[model samples]
Target: MRNDVRALRLSGGLSQAELAGAMGVSRQTVNAIETGRYSPSLTLAVRLARYFERTVEEVFHVDCD
Candidate 1:
């Protein structure tokens, strides 16, 4: 999966730690997500998209390989 998390965070004037605080996760977790090393759960994904005022599909992209 690929996501716009980093761009969104930056455009929203948020640091990884700040985004994590809002998302109720750790900065490391936010880093993991941004780096594509980890994928968030559906619930968390929804929350993230909602926080950014975006749809899940807008924030997350399912890569076909």
Candidate 2:
């Protein structure tokens, strides 16, 4: 999976730490998500969508191989 999290956060004027705090996660977790080093769980994904006020599809995308 690939996500537009960094772009979204930047556009929203949120730093990584701010986004992490809003999502109730660690900054490293957000970094991991942004870097594609980790894939968020469904719950986290939902939380992220809720925080950004966006649909999951708007925040994340399935990258076909």
Candidate 3:
């Protein structure tokens, strides 16, 4: 999966640690997600989308690989 997490977080002026804290996850988790090393679960995805005031499709995109 590819996501706009990094861009969004940066645009929102949030650090990975801050985002992780807000998301109730570890900084590593946020790093992994931003780097496409890990994909968030559906529930977590929804939470993230909601937190950013974006739809899941807007936040995350299928890589089409």
What TM-score against the true fold does each predicted structure earn?
0.96, 0.90, 0.94
Candidate 2, residue 14: lDDT: 95
Expressed as tens digits, the lDDT of each residue in 1-65 for candidate 2 is 89989998999999999999988899999999999999999999988988889999899998786
Local accuracy of candidate 3 as per-residue lDDT tens digits, 1-65: 99999999999999999999999999999999999999999999999999999999999998777
**Which residue pairs of candidate 1 clash?**
none
Candidate models: Cα lDDT each: 0.97, 0.92, 0.97
Candidate 3 local distance difference test against the native: 0.97
Off by over 4 Å in 1: none
How are the candidates ranked when ordered by TM-score, highest leading?
Answer: 1, 3, 2
Compared to the true structure, candidate 2 yields what TM-score? 0.90
Q: For each candidate, C-alpha RMSD in Å?
A: 0.8, 1.1, 1.1
Angstrom error at residue 28, model 3: 0.3
Residue 54, candidate 1: alpha-carbon lDDT: 99
Q: At residue 42, what lDDT does model 3 achieve?
A: 98
Better of 1 and 2 by lDDT: 1
Model 2 global lDDT (CA atoms, 0 to 1): 0.92
